[model samples]
Target chain A: MTVQARSLVQITAPRQTGPTLLDRMRRSSLLMAILAPLAILIVWECLTRVGLLDQRFFPAPSSIIVSLFALVESGRVFIDAAWTIGRMLVGFVFGAVPGIVFGIMLGLSPTVRAFLQPVIAALYPVPKIALFPLIMMIFGIGEASKWAIVAIAVFFQVFYSTLAGVVNIDRIYLDVASNFKATRWQLCRTIAIPGALPFIFTGCQLGIGMALVIVVIAENFGTQVGLGYLIWQSWQVFEVRDMFVYLLMVSLLGYGSQMAILRLQRAVIPWKKDDAG
Target chain B: MSSDPSTTLDRTGLSPPAFPKIRVRGLGKRFQVGKAWVEAIKAIDLDVQAGEFICIVGPSGCGKTTLLRILADLEAPTEGEVTIEQSDPSNPLSSMIFQESSILPWMSIRRNVAYGLELRGVPAAEIDKSVDRFLALTGLDRFADAYPHQLSGGMKQRASVARAFANNPEILLMDEPFAALDEQNKALLQEELLRIWSETRKTVIFITHSIDEALVLGDRVIVMSRRPGRLKTEFKIDFPRPRRVYDLKANPEFGRIGREIWTLLREEVVGP
Candidate 1:
């Protein structure tokens, strides 16, 4: 009969009376998230086959599959995909790690937060992509420049969410910890980290998306490898089908990664799932 | 002041078997509420015995829960202290059951019961043994792996009790643990509590506003005065054990004791 268990009892007791409209909507939304994409893909394949849409501008799913197979057989696509994934991993690590550390520092100390507020605020709105020329000038359009672009994008996105997470944890839990004679490090490890997990993971998800965007734009500026390079090169040579093939691959990779992260989240936070029900 | 239980119990033919395990001498508590100094408890003195089921009942604004919190060491008293002979201060020897149970939702039932042991740095082997024993004592063995969300209200409270007892604390502090449950669950829990208390023989200080609840579980009921709480009076029930509310209500002594408590409570509920 812990407090949490008692609360669950009270919460479910009142709501068990009816099949409310809100419950129906929640079930419907879950179904839609699963089914809507498949329906659209089917419609897309049909439209392209019947010549209702121009295949040059919008290649059929079958043609994209052929191009994907051709690229994979030549081994160029695997190397490019690996390079893109590797860059994302490196950039994500560089950006998210420092962003989380600094964010925690800022959240813990209002003085530090205040001191850095104006600097972050000024730079946050200036899109990092707009400074690609300056970055190229500084780093000379190598892997370093691409990684830096991705890192810069990731840092700001993660920093804000981490700060919000730390700042919003309930104060009462902290008070309870202190009363129980928890040491400073113990408090942070038990209370602070668990309290901030939901927010931090959210930031990671957002930052990963931003990192993908930067990788494309950064590779487009100058590079001989990566998914972004493939698309840029294909567009220039009138290989529209090849360009669409790269686009579809990148989309699938991004979507698949997000789904994997969500599954990891469920494993890590089973408590939230039970509570939601 | 008379140690002669014979006068109170001999005529009624039930001996007063319980003895006090903790003492409160001239106890008082004060707090600064905004700009003004507010007195929460005024020179309250009471005695609770080993294995004695005692309940402190008062109105909403009265410091009934506050008194229990002080005993639990969740808060320090501004004025006086409570003395428990067996309480080791070096190692925590008192476990509390809050109004809400307060079990960590993230933990499974077995882990929740093992929490106090973990806090005390008990060896893993011994903690596992003790958790298993108390889980059986509270009849939560079937729910060892279940999350808090999977339990019913009565079952959750049972888990909370198991958690408290698993610590092997000398005393247990319960602050309205069953107040939120429906009448059926509340009654069943009360009966289970009596059984557990008898088996474990741990001192219990229970706080509640329910008069019937106080009469049912308490060996000696201490009625407190409204706000600026003080010990109004105490009553020793001469009823026989294996006592349930239904059985107690049927006894002639139950009606007499119930009437006497109603009179004490009426004074506090009304004026003078």
Candidate 2:
């Protein structure tokens, strides 16, 4: 029935108000996304069954699914996923809030920006993960260390872009604010905050990605309940399927949270929604 | 050829107002461009009567904007004083309609129009009432909830006009408010503005490069010399009140006034 509809639409595309090929493809894009990986897995399963690949390193897709089910049934996925997400959220909130405030300050005052630009510029280029050891030593090798590393990483991402957003607001808007006899508080509320919101969101997207990268690495030590530690432990025990399961959790966290932030942005700053038209 | 304008208005004793609303004495402005000082306007002295519509016309880069900015208190004069008498203490000192669209992009047309009042902590009910009135007056009633990015250029300019008028400031400072509009929209907006101005009789100081625009809008046109912009001369626009732009343009007297101002402006920029 689907095939008949497809051919009929193709023959009389312009006349019919039916969904365009692109729209139809978009509906099936998720299926396409699933199909490609499923095809790869099927090829791998055949390769393994024929003994062309080693099961020791390259397990069959079916067996991997069995172990994935075992991991979920054992309740290992729930606890570890919670620990990792909690650390990221706590760190992100801490970093992003202060970063935005400081960014606004820098944007508002040229003198403040001038004095601090050198200090921030010198630190911005430093690999945040490189400071993990130093952070662990200072914050102690525990959840504090994990949270601290994530916060520091996310701070620069949010801070610089927030400053850029505020700085780049057209001068006329600021002039308009003053012409209305706006006080300092009114200026920030009316002009600075709204103007900087777009760049702040961009910074947050980058910050979240950075958080995912650093959180997994930070979990390598000083933590045992996160997906990062689960992946590392599975690798040590040669439980390849369990390792893949934990890796999937990390990917979902990254993808899900980015989409969540975008949703929130669309709601909170609805004025900056997708396009001018 | 139009005769040259006198270099000083005070010396010539032109149409002096009995009660000046704004008095400017030897006003000058200089900006530091990199290392050198670029004088924007020099030793400008003038007086504007209450309820007068004054237009400042000069060539491009002739500091017309700078003069308006100083009047609006957006910039400080380097060498002189500008004093605007407080005719109505309850009302705001001034509201400026910028060369660029000054309405905030994040705000809806209603909120943008109500901005000055909102900042002043006016009651929300009062804001809703006055804002709706101005929105209807400017024909932005339907677009009250629309964002600026969704509107056409002329419509955006209308939102600004609505905003400035709704604020009910004592003086209206406009810096080429219609410069970016096409001729048709400019004419329509000019007519709309005249209707609004006639109702309010607000003191307006407008800046423009077009002599025709000045003649169409101003009670008097002040001409300025090119860069280091000194006030070169003035012309009184005696055309009747509540004028229509098309009707005024069709009149032979209007073209003669525009050319008289234009020739004087050209001579001021080049030579006598």
Candidate 3:
């Protein structure tokens, strides 16, 4: 009977050890995500070393890294990155804050929505980058014009997203507020703003990316301090390695900004569970 | 049908006031659905005594919710008026509890409970005390800091109830508050509601479709007919106070009253 009981215990409870390989892999998924790019870099380095690709156009990964390091050490990278980031942030703030405010107004008042809808429809579809010449005429071919271009690009994105956000708030919440005798201001403060937060974060994410893109395009003309100017200068001189370095920096900056925005969203709106995970 | 004077007097305590807590005179509601106007309710007249628990029961789409909404001042009646007699100038006339979860999703359970008091500009210390009291009463003290999304459906509804009670409204208007809860949770909430109602003695106007629920909770059960709803019948339930919801249903008197209401309700449900 004792022997039978021991066998049953073994069947009921398997001997415990540690996490399985799959569990460990899942835990270190971020490392696996980095591994793919590292493997690609290694293969590209091997291919270049073997002389399978021409060195003139496609420089080795090691040489590109060396160029990157030299660019950073020269202090030019900081100036260019600062210029780009500053332009994006200044333009983004000016554009997005007003956009969100006006969006909320339009969403809450049907009269305002009706009055602005036609004008918004007319202006929203026109590519904001294409307005750079007109903006240059008004603000001059300086930082003002670049800021205008970036701001216009970001404004429409944020405005539309915020409007959609406020408009989509469940009517039930408003009714509940009304039942509690909430004033108009109280309704906006307590119900409307918090309810529309998720969508506003989405708008911010989109607006930032658009601001980055417009800044690059704006810098391509009459700008010398930004990463866009560096890329343009490199391409003009046919320095492919330097151009690639700038491109990589731009990509990294975009990725980093997006991740930062996502982190902010997670922190501010912890109630929104990420079901995708 | 109008309320009986003797029952209203008994519920309102000694030296009953000249006016009822709520007086509805020819209350009617019509909605403009698409192009045509749909009559949701027609000429509802009700006089609810102070400290009375009244349950309004009807078939689906019979405008019981519309009537409750009108009483809570959430909706304007197409015709007629609702007058709430507020004795205290400082207190709000009414607070509503919806059928679905109405606790603010972004707010913690404690914040949601404290919201009404905050809106009323109550002192911070008083708000915190009332919030704590109601949270403990509803058995949600442990989840005070948790967001609504982190709570179960029943707990969220409990938070909603606690919020209304903490506001200390003169009248509580509930529209099928437990309609979405399961049988077990419904029983638990019903008991909690009874306990709270007995202690507070605030005038309650509850709307529900369940006959058993109406019999278990209401001092008087008001039945209404189909769309363009009108009062069909009223049953004065005299179930003793400090009632156990679970045991109430098993009582033979509970079944007899429930069946009588159901019989009156069946004709309205079946048409003509």
Candidate 4:
């Protein structure tokens, strides 16, 4: 009977076709997103060229592009971008790994949650950048202090998000796992982590944005070789075009990191594709 | 029907005939709603034979789900006990199919069907073979690679049912598994389930609110009273095996049993 049914299903099932060109274009939202920003840049360029706006504050898009090219030719852009990316990566890894671990621990154990909740709640809202002087005293105003500030900023975001994710896992899924007689380790591996992952991804995305913001602010104090310092240095020297160049780099860095995280989410949670459709 | 209903014995009054598959003795459950403790099931006593299909029909909030949950060992009974005779040590005693399609949304149809066996540390080759067999049985072979969200509600429930059957559990506990489906899908699934049940002969405890559903699918239908659910009545259905759900609806005996069970159920629903 099963064999007969299998053959019947195969014969009756519709053939899957390759996506058409219009379907492919519709699926790629990134192309549409680029248009809006491109339009804004064009309008900004026209306004600056025709003297509708002050050139001192708002440099022409063409002049900013030229300065961007000049920075690239000097190889300073590469150095600054690498430094900024390295600090963000290092800080994010250091903060997020432990944050997720501790968050899971806290989420699963009410006792641990009771002991740690008050402390986390107290420190979570304090702007981490305000603690720069204190961190600088402890780590001595080098890359360590900047790294510390960025890590602290990222830690809270990942921790709270992960905690929320773990706590909010549907009880029915857990009941299903237990009913199947899954061991604790198997439950965690198969059910808990996969169930909590969407929210955890949201946390990581938010952490990345926070990390970029804090790293830039942290660089303002001690660093001489990052995009943040480049922006500040250009401003001190009264070079509007150079400042705009650094600002554009910062924007690109933020955009690039966000896209990277989004790509990771897609690869890991492939089932989410149907949710959009 | 040629079968005799009188041959079936009520567990409350008579001892089970040798080696019952499941035994529930004075089972009860109570939940704390706010400050007060509310009794869900005051007591339930039942003995299920090997390969018997038992359907439980009850009013809403009658703790039918709670009873099923206790049998699945998903919840602890506040009082009494449930014991399952482990006929096979290799297979799990029971696998439950929930009211909602509990197929993990992250897993593809094939993987969802393979989940229970995989969790039991069954080898990959065996899982593949079993998954293939059950998927074909459920007519879901064409959708093996599709995720739960990609499938329709009926297909999702079919995948979940396939998952339970593929595990080859000794007993299947289903809590209103087809209640959310449309009429056509529900009837189609019921027939598919009967075919699967006949082939496997696994002891089944199916919970439902519909008397017609109970009459069509079960070898015996057990009715329960309202809140603090207690076993009120049991009817031995004499419907022959290999019965089609649609055909059963037209049977005069089916309507007779449905009306009898509905009268028992309506009292709990309408009060007094």
**Model 3 C-alpha lDDT versus the unseen true structure:** 0.87
Chain A TM-scores, one per candidate?
0.81, 0.87, 0.88, 0.85
Candidate 3 off by > 4 Å? A1-27, A46-54, A275-277, B1-16
Models ranked on lDDT = 2, 4, 3, 1
CA-based DockQ, model 1 = 0.14
Runs in model 4 with CA error above 4 Å?
Answer: A1-54, A273-277, B1-17
Query: Number of the top candidate by DockQ?
Result: 3
Q: Rank the candidates by TM-score, best first.
A: 3, 2, 4, 1
Tens-place lDDT per residue, model 3, B53-74, is: 9999999999999898877767
| DockQ (CA atoms), all models | 0.14, 0.54, 0.62, 0.53
Q: Over the stretch A1-277, how does candidate 1's per-residue lDDT look in tens digits? A: 6455444433344545666887776779677687877888788899998989888888887787788788878989878988998888798889999888877878767899999978998999998898778878998888887888889899998899889988997764554454344566656665666667778888888988998888987888767899999989998998987898889879977877667667776787666644231
TM-score of each: 0.75, 0.90, 0.91, 0.88
Tens digits of per-residue lDDT for model 2 on B34-116?
Answer: 99999999989898988899999998898889988877767767878766766666778889999888889998989999999
User: Any runs in candidate 1 off by more than 4 Å, and if so which?
Assistant: A1-66, A94-200, A221-223, A234-239, A273-277, B1-43, B47-52, B82-90, B266-272
lDDT of each: 0.79, 0.88, 0.87, 0.87
Off by over 4 Å in 2: A1-23, A26-54, A273-277, B1-19, B269-272
Report the Cα interface RMSD of each model, rounded to 1 decimal. Answer: 3.1, 1.2, 1.0, 0.9
Worst 10 residues of 4 chain A by lDDT: A1-10
> DockQ ranking from best to worst?
3, 2, 4, 1
